[model samples]
Target: MPEKVKTDLGFADLQCRKSDVGRISRIAKAAYSFNRRFFGKEIKKPFHIIICYSRKEFDDIWGAETDAWLTGFATKTGTIVSFRDDLIRKYNPRKEATLAGTLRHEINHIFYFQIYGSYEPAWLLEGLTLQPPFEPFTLMENDKKRLKGPLPHLIYSTNGKTFFKQAPFLYSMAFLATRH
Candidate 1:
C-alpha cells in the first residue's frame, strides 16, 4: 500500500503506485486543460496535488483542522484527497468511482481555486464548478439512476444553500438551471 501522512485538512502523501500515479496525473492534467478552455486562456502555474489512501493518514496530514465530513480539500499549496481502502475493497473493487468521482471532484476544486483565488459563495462556486463544459461533469451521464429528470420549478425558487442539502434535489435544479 502507498504511504499517507496526516495534514492540516486531511492526508498528505505522494502517489507512488504506477497506476494510481498515472490516474491522478491524467485527471489533474484534464482539470487544468478544462480550466484553460473555460477561461479561454492557459493558466500558467502548475498544480501540486497530494493523495492519501486511509483515514489515519488523512488525519495525520490534516493535523488539527476541525471540520468533519471533508472527504477531500483543495488549497493553493496543494490538494488533499482521501479514499478508504476498505471502501475500495468492499464496493469499488474495480476503482471506477475512485477515478471518476473523487479524483475529478477534488481536481475541479483545485481548478476553481486557480480561477477564483478567494472562497466564493459556495452556491455560485460549487454550482458553476459542478456544471457542464467540464469533463467530469460530463461523466454524470454514466450514473443515470442518480438523475431525477426535470426538477420541479419550486426547487429552483429556493436558495442553493437550502436545496443543496438534498443533493438529488440540487442536482435536478442544477440540470434545470443550466438548461435554456
Candidate 2:
C-alpha cells in the first residue's frame, strides 16, 4: 500500500516498498515542479502516480507478460512508472535519472490529453508530449540501420496498434518538427 502526498497541482500518491520512499519522493517532487512550470495551473482533476519497485511487481499489477523495457505509461486517470530493481542493482547506474525522465514524459501525456482532449493528431499529440527536455533520441540510440530512411513516411504509416513499437523514432521526429 502507498500513502498520499499533498501537492498544489492535483492529487498525488506514492506506492513502493519502504526502502524506495525517499527516491520516489524526489522523483515525484520533480514531476510536480515540471507540471507547475509547464501547465501554469493545477490540473482539473487529481493525478495519481504509482512507482512499482520492480518489473515483476509492474507486470503483476498490469497483467503484462514481458519484462518491461518501456519503463512507464499514462492514461487519463494516472501514470505508472516502473524501475527494474534487479537491473538497477546489477547494470544501470542511471536508473533513477531514467525514472525521473519517464515520470515527466508520462505525466506530460496525461496533462496534454486533459487540456486538448484525446482527439488530437498522433504526431501533434506526441510532439507536444515530448516538449519537456528529455532524451527522446535514446530510444533509437543503438539502431543505426533503422535511422536511414525518410522519417515522416515511417511516422505517417504508424497507427495506434503499431505506435508503441515506433514511438521512440516517431516521437523524436515529431518533437523536432513541432518544436520549431
Candidate 2 collision pairs: none
TM-score each candidate: 0.54, 0.70
The 10-residue segment with the lowest total lDDT in model 2? 88-97
Instruction: State residue 168's C-alpha deviation in candidate 1, in Å.
Output: 11
Quickly count the clashes in candidate 2: 0
Off by over 4 Å in 1: 2-14, 64-69, 84-97, 133-180
Quote the lDDT for 101 in model 1: 53
lDDT of 2 by residue, 1-180 (tens): 454343332356666666676777777778767865787866666666766665676667666654334556675555555553454433342344366666676667777777777725666766665664643434345343445665444355444557667755676677666777
lDDT of 2: 0.60
All candidates: CA RMSD (Å): 7.1, 4.4
Determine which window of 10 residues in candidate 1 has minimal summed lDDT.
4-13
